[model samples]
Target: MDKNKEKRPSFVKRFLRQTPHAITMLFGIIVLVSVLTYILPAGSYDRVLLNGRNVVVPNSYKIITSTPIDFLGLFKAIPLGFKSAADIIFVVFAGAIMFAFMEKSKAVENSVGTLLKKMGFGRKHLLIVIFTFIYGFLGVAVGYENNIAMVPIAAVLSLALGGDLILAAGISVGAMTIGFGLSPINPYTVGTGHKIAELAMFSGYGLRSVLCFIALSSMAYYNVRYFKKITKNPEKSLGKGLDEEGISLSKPIQEYSVTANNWLVLSIFLMGLAVIIYGVFNLNWYLIELSAVFLIIALLCGIVSRMGATLMSETVLKAVSLAAPGAFMVGFATTIKVLMEMGNIGDTISYNLALLLQDMSLYTSAISMAVSQSVINFFIPSGSGQALATLPVMLPLGETLGLTRQTTILAFQIGDGISNLVNPTLGGLIAMLAMCRVPLDRWLRFIFPMVLVLLLMSCVALIVAVATGYN
Candidate 1:
């Protein structure tokens, strides 16, 4: 027993070290299973009279399989690459450049810092929670640009509140993800799902939004508990040697004088915000026209702030340079979409899952759909893509099972929202982490449990739907 006890800790340490790679290995197993299942056919059994007794037996012993891809099929699938992959890459590049400019200028940092100082966040926890929630809400309502702004604000507030920077980063991500998760109007995920599924334009999207609101509220409550504990015991909370990192903001805030250089920075940020607002809100202008406006703003600000024409050209060039890495990440994500198409992997996987769900009892089908979609979400990460990819298969299966399409769609939305809490690949996560200066490990410590809680809540919600049936 003593020997076993000593061995257990080492085993656990090894398991923990291997778990991240395990996720990748598990995904590979899933893909292999998907391909085999898609390519192999099981013989159908039929009832027959054998001698004097009725019996069931497989008559046709040959397995049959059909492949979706020939040269023609591959050619046809290529156009989807542009639609699914290229667009995401281009948009991400545009957004990143816009953000880098905002960050370097200190517009995001100063604006957020200035606001938090006025709120007296150190003395009050309620205001901080409310303000954080609002920041998240505005982020979703405004989409990506406004969401990016919320990150710095959330981080600065974390410093003001005397909370751990890492915890603050997690909280920042939680808020942004909440907004992204709940979005009723955004065409990317929920809205697109509703349209593709032929559900109402607004549908019960409002219901999912309400659920996200509840989830965010629960998260905030937990954060308050932790924040209060930290505030009461600063030494324990800050820990030893955590202040050494250059990223740590516990140092005294020095007064910064806004010079010509600073004003030049501020103008670039304000112009970016103006362009984003105009583009996203559909503010009665062409995208090209809006781009022109930003260009003019950049030029005029540069000239007024004593940035010579040559320097202005260099600044634009430099901003584009900084955006390139983000563009690459986005491109890599798009490449996954392309590969899935090439493999017909998405359709095959969805069809198999749908088939499995269809075999379950009716109530089970609804709950199973939620559980299944939630599991799939850990990989896809894009709620709209998951919805689009799976709904075609699941919706037909749901109809055949006599389940309400709306209910199944609701299940998908719930599953999608809950998974976002831990989806590290999300762009909003990087922004939030950068803003709050939190490492990934610290985030998982708090957030992983919270996500599990939300997952349990989702199960409970689905059970209620199963028990009551949809109105």
Candidate 2:
């Protein structure tokens, strides 16, 4: 039996089993939640979801029915939403390309291998764990750059070490997610959550950092255990390579010629750095548009280095092509938010959940709201949107139940952050997984435990908030 396997079913497990067997399960859930919130009347509640700053009163069925869903209308609206999420896609792609050039140049690989060889860090599992912790920490600091930058390193190192490629990618990508999940200043997640809740910009920073620390620790422990098993019986745990039969450990490392690679590599790295800096500082979209110039620079450099225009054009086009699904997911996700606002789904979900727990004690209300936020996360993947949609409704209930609004906001962040790890629709996770060839089942196996630990920890923290009257 696998040592890490759990014997009993948890609530989340049972719920996941019930999820539709579709590639894009979240989209189906979105449609269902849309109907539930818009079609069903709030029996005794006053408010529904919001549009801008307006309260959606129930019995506004006419407005819901009249929502414009024409093909052209959706087409037009999607670009705007894509524009909103454009910064994220741009940063993700540029960072990946930049990191690719570095790895292609053998700079990162040689550096990591030399460092590991010097330190005798051949215990693959322990090294992975330490790297994961650092990755997670830097994720919060350097933010999304870590994902684009480190994923290739992890993959290359795992290959060189004769270990799991997927495991290496997991440590690097997961750490970056941990930071993005617990961002201090990034407008993508935490900043958006604050805006939604109408709370101070930094209100949830401390709690997020604490949760991120614990979650990363849990992930490291899991990695260490896996490595220990692999160490005990390398063949059985780590499995054989693709060329298993009669294969010797004599594969020649692929070499990139410096003369032919330098200019292209240099152009990619410099341009990527510029874009990431601009994104971090929340500069104008003109900076993102400037990527075209960088692509041109890469092309010119490649041409000068005896590289064909076709190769350079193909590479840049491929990079752009890889980003299309991410852009689409963003637009689709934005539409869900628009629908919720149109149908007043946020208020309905919040108000009813609130009233159901209104009679409970303060700690109970806090716990309940935390759990509710996790559920709300499925429908509203954007942390900010979920916070905005649900906070108004949940905050008032927290007040009535003698719970702190601040605690509720923190709970919201925790729930939203954890879901992003496994939510198939989260473009960053999807792209990272694609790069690593890690299927959803494998990632879920590794991540589910960490998610439970983080969720329970968050609930307990919220309980403490209730006890101390934090706000």
- Winner by lDDT: 2
**Which residue pairs collide in model 2, if any?**
49-344
lDDT tens digits, residue span 43-145, model 2? 3234444434433232332223324334454445445545655655564465444443343344455555555565565466667777888778767776553
lDDT of each: 0.55, 0.57
Tens digits of per-residue lDDT for model 1, 1-471 = 598776665543354444443224433543443354346443222334533333323222233244434445444543543355454444434443344344445544555454555654454577557865776676467664345544544555566556666546546677667666656565556666666667777566545666767777876787777777777776645222333132223334444234556556676657666776766667644334434444554555555556566665667676555445444443333333454445534444455566688578877778788777776775466666676556655666777887666677767776676666655444445334433444434455556667777777766766666666552
Off by over 4 Å in 2: 1-104, 121-123, 144-150, 183-208, 230-271, 282-306, 314-347
Score residue 233 of candidate 2 by CA lDDT: 73
Q: lDDT of model 1 at residue 214?
A: 76
**Candidate 2, poorest ten consecutive residues by summed lDDT:** 242-251
